[model samples]
Target: GAGVSQTPSNKVTEKGKYVELRCDPISGHTALYWYRQSLGQGPEFLIYFQGTGAADDSGLPNDRFFAVRPEGSVSTLKIQRTERGDSAVYLCASSSLGLAGGSQETQYFGPGTRLLVL
Candidate 1:
């Protein structure tokens, strides 16, 4: 009955440090997504996972970013060598099914984890 939820509502770290953001999606949802939102802009897709493997990872900006959904229910976004430019709100969303043939599915978003690189 619970909805999507993210941990550490906020995070502060220095550049070059590593951080792991966690996301717990709604139970039974088959599709999960990770996104990043910068100032004055909407959330940008980073990755999508259907089950245990990453279905789409094209949105990943660089090799420093990676995500995994090991068991298909919980996911973790790992950032290696954090940068000042990466300071933004990291969001997680889940849906019953990912976009199928141009049809849309309602995605429930968690209160993003606001990361600040200081």
Candidate 2:
């Protein structure tokens, strides 16, 4: 894809249900990030992956949230025991050399997946 792309633009699930959000980043990008945006707020960083390993996951709210990048191209964010408080827009972004920390790199963002827990 030309830019980052996420699957299932919208998802609605009952409380305690499990959900998986998929993100396919631009081809060849090495750095991927996941974020969450609530009403009237900016996106909050959740995790960042450099290749298949998670470089930073400190932003994850709790143990219930997890993300993985298996082949370094596609990533998935998994949520266990979803709650109404989890309702938000989940965003995915990718950059070619952002994690290198030499120079700032622009990250391409996807349309995001709106998750609503009832």
lDDT of 2 at 106: 88
Q: Which runs in model 1 stand beyond 4 Å of their true positions?
A: 98-103
**lDDT by residue for model 1 over 1-118, one digit each (tens)?**
9989999899999999999999999999888999999999999999999889999999999999999999999999999999999999999999887456211888999999999998
Q: Roughly what TM-score does model 2 have, to 2 decimal places?
A: 0.95
> Model 2 lDDT vs. the true structure?
0.94
lDDT of 2 by residue, 4-94 (tens): 8999999999999999999999999888999999999999999999889999999999999999998988999999999999999999999
